[model samples]
Target: MTLRTATAGDLTAIMDLERTSFPTDAWSEPMMQSELASPHGRYLVDVEAGRVIGYGGVRAVQGSADADIQTIALAEAARGRGRGRTLLRALLEVARERGAREMFLEVRADNPVATALYASEGFVEIGRRPRYYQPDDVDAVIMTLDLVAWAAHRAADGTALDAGACS
Candidate 1:
């Protein structure tokens, strides 16, 4: 699989992946189109067999050097192959290079896979927003990671954190 920065051309496949990975909370086509055009945002995709198998979105606030992960998902057929973690690490690397010092995201409290992935990536549970996932009314758990530390760990380990070790 190959991961690359997304462009408008990748919108259709991205939406396709979103629909399958997040049936109840998929991002609309326009929502994705806008992100691809945003100056402060980035969208990335992992391609396999010429298809977008997984993707991630993030926004980096210019002045503050803060970044927030908007969403990350993998196609149903792409799960369990560590693609999700790879996409996340790539996004985080983009965040760090863009001068972001911190990163944050919200996940469903019951999404063990996501929560675990975030945790293993050096994210710490900071707090939660009760019933934040309105689509399903599931609580949202907030997690934060210190990019400096994360990078140091990755460097010390001689590579990016392995998704296999997630949670």
Candidate 2:
């Protein structure tokens, strides 16, 4: 799949995937629209054959010491193919570009696949919010990544920290 910057024009397709991926607690259209319009927000979508298969977003300000990963979701058909990792890494790179020294996110405790992906990427559990997910009553596993440490690991592993720009 190819990755590129997400735009407001991608809203409908993104909302479709967002609803499908998080049926119980998908974000409302207005909220997403605001996020997409925010100057501090960075979002990306992965497309294949003109279909949106995955998307990720982050909230960061230039020279900030910390950034928060807003969301990351993939179409059911895109799982098990490393698209999540691709999107995640891209987001991290974007955060670093925006001058973030660290990053954070909250993943559903019930999601082993996503949790594993985060763990493999050097995100360590820093805290948890009890029953943070409504309806399902799932806990939110809070994770954080030290950009400096992650970058050193990437360099040691021969992975470019600045993989690519969002656009």
Clashes of each: 0, 0
Misplaced by over 4 Å in model 1 are 160-167
lDDT of 2 by residue, 53-73 (tens): 889999989889999999999
Assess the local accuracy of residue 163 in candidate 2 as a C-alpha lDDT between 0 and 100.
Answer: 39
lDDT of 1 by residue, 28-111 (tens): 889889998998977888888887788898887665567999999897778888888888998887788778989999999989
Alpha-carbon lDDT of model 1: 0.84
Candidate 2 colliding pairs, count: 0
Question: Which candidate should be chosen as best, given TM-score against the real structure?
Answer: 2
Residue 52 error for model 1, in Å?
A: 0.8
Score candidate 2 by lDDT. 0.90
The TM-score of candidate 2 is 0.96
